[model samples]
Target: MTPKEYLEIVHIINELKDTPRHCVTKNNRIESVAEHSWRIAMMALLLEDTFSDVDIDKVMRMCVIHDLGECFTGDIPVFLKTDDDRRQEAKLLDEFLDTLPEQLSHNMRALYQEMEACQSREAKIFKALDKLEAVIQHNEAPISSWEEHEYDLQRHYAFDVVAFSSWLSELREEILQETEYKIQQEQ
Candidate 1:
């Protein structure tokens, strides 16, 4: 790929840095989509030992690329995102990917397909981490930083996503414990 092409592609993805998600940071700052992606990538790296059966490297890639669509549509909270919202993100991201250098575009397209399928082990792990990361961040942020409905979202959001693996389920429970403690403290 030419240097010009590479930089241009990154410049487009740079939109994610400005895209904000619903999760707040511990400092009471709204976290960007890029921050969310970075944590899931970190979560994938940290899980390498625990999920030895899967291709952790690919999981990491999926984690990084899963939310690229947010660069275009910005973030829609899981509770509010509709099917059309998802379609628009995918469409815009697909258009952006097509403009990338050939192999990089191919790789990203494959990762997006794998993530959408959510059937392969790598895909499942990435998906679970994606959901869990938001919950983890919410738990870290002050109680007043959260919207009232998020308490319920934190309790039940990732249950099904992580149900395929006991380790993931256990991690979810640990996050749930933290959420319970936070709620108790607030009460």
Candidate 2:
């Protein structure tokens, strides 16, 4: 890649650090998209043993790149996203991908597409880790920071993790229980 191309990619990637995770409660300090991506990538690596048939490398890549569009569109909270938001995000992702060399852009685009499609084992695992990380972060945040409605939404997200893998489902339950206990202790 040319020096200009390399710098362009770096600039776009750097935007992730400034993009806050929008689903998280606004009362608490929010995590950047970059931070969320790092946690999801780590979770994918750590939890790979639970899935015997997934491609760990692809899962990691998907976790990291899944939100690249957010660097452009900003993080749209899942509950608030409309069809227009989805279209906008896809357009922004394509523009971001266009900044890279053809091969790299193609690969990253494919990874993002696979994650969205949620068809392959690796994609499914990555999707589970994405939701799992959100719940984990929410649990770590101050209990008082979350409104009742936010808690309900997060709990439902935890349950949705079950659709990907049984091991992740069990972990989700454990996280929910732990969060409940922590809230009780705070009371």
Candidate 3:
């Protein structure tokens, strides 16, 4: 890779590392997007029972590289991302993937495309796990830490829960219930 490209990659990784996530954990730690992706991939593996028809490997791959485009676009909180912004973000993702080796780019692009469609069982399940994890993290955090994610959930993500499997959807609903309980407990 050229020095410029190498620097671009490095810069991207560093920015992701520094990006703060909306939810906090039981340990009072904020999760980064990178960590969130890793965790969700594991969630897919462990919860494969919920996604019978989908390829687990592909689902995992999709989850793993799903947010890589965010390395360039920065972390757009789920709530603040407008429909136009999401379309632009998708374009940005494609452009960045094109920078990779052909095979790698092709695979990542396919994975991202699958994620976007969310038509497959795996895609739906993956989306559910992704949001569920965030809600879980937010629930575990102190009450004061719930603004960006909660706002996003109410504004943009309110109807997204039904897009996933029943299991995943239930998990998401449970997360919200848990978060509310936690907030009440904290108060």
Candidate 4:
């Protein structure tokens, strides 16, 4: 990569350095998007053992790249998206991806679309863990920033998370349960 390309990537990473996720660690501290991405990738690798039908590499790649667009769009919470807002976000993500070299841009756009489509097993697992990580982070963090976004339990249930939606649909419950358990242990 040229210095210019490297600097752009660095700038994106820097922009996200302070952006907090919906979850806090067990110690009640905020985690950055970079940390969240790293954990999600780890989750994809760990869950690969159970998802025999999924392409683990593809799933991991999807998880790692899923939020790259957020580097530009910022972390727009799922519940906050109106129809027009979503359409604009989609356009922004595509346009941002297009800024890359031809092949790289194509690949990133395709991956983003595949993730949104969630038609494949890999996409399914990635989406599931994405929610899971957010809830987990919220539990560990000091603030209920996620709740402030109005992403209540019902909305989460209504959201379509593709392949594992039926099975992993209780992300809201999982987050609350895990948070409760952690709080109890601390006491």
- Clash count for each candidate, listed in order shown: 0, 0, 1, 7
Per-residue alpha-carbon lDDT of candidate 1 for residues 1-187, written as tens digits (9 for 90 to 100): 8889778878988999999988889999989999999989998999889988889999989988888888889999988999999889888988998888788889899888888899999999998999999899999999998888898998999899999999999999999999999999998
Query: Which should have the higher TM-score, number 1 or number 2?
Result: 1
**Candidate 3 C-alpha error for residue 72, in Å:** 1.0
Model 2, 1-187: lDDT tens digits are: 9998788788878999999875454357777999899888998888667775778989999988888888888988777899999999899889877868899989997888787788888887888888788778878777776767776765677576466667777888898887778677888
The residue pairs that clash in candidate 4, if any, are 22-138, 23-137, 23-138, 24-137, 24-138, 24-140, 24-141
Q: On a 0 to 100 scale, what is the lDDT of residue 104 in model 2?
A: 96
Best by TM-score: 1
Best by lDDT: 1
lDDT of 3 by residue, 31-69 (tens): 788888888889889876656677888778877777776
Cα error of candidate 3 at position 115, Å: 1.4
* Candidate 3, pairs of clashing residues: 79-152
Q: Is candidate 2 or candidate 3 better by lDDT?
A: 2
Give the Å error, residue 71, model 3: 0.7
Which sections of candidate 1 miss by over 4 Å?
none
lDDT of 1 at 38: 91
lDDT of 4: 0.68
Please give the lDDT score at residue 33 for candidate 1. Answer: 94
The candidate, 2 or 4, that scores higher on lDDT is 2
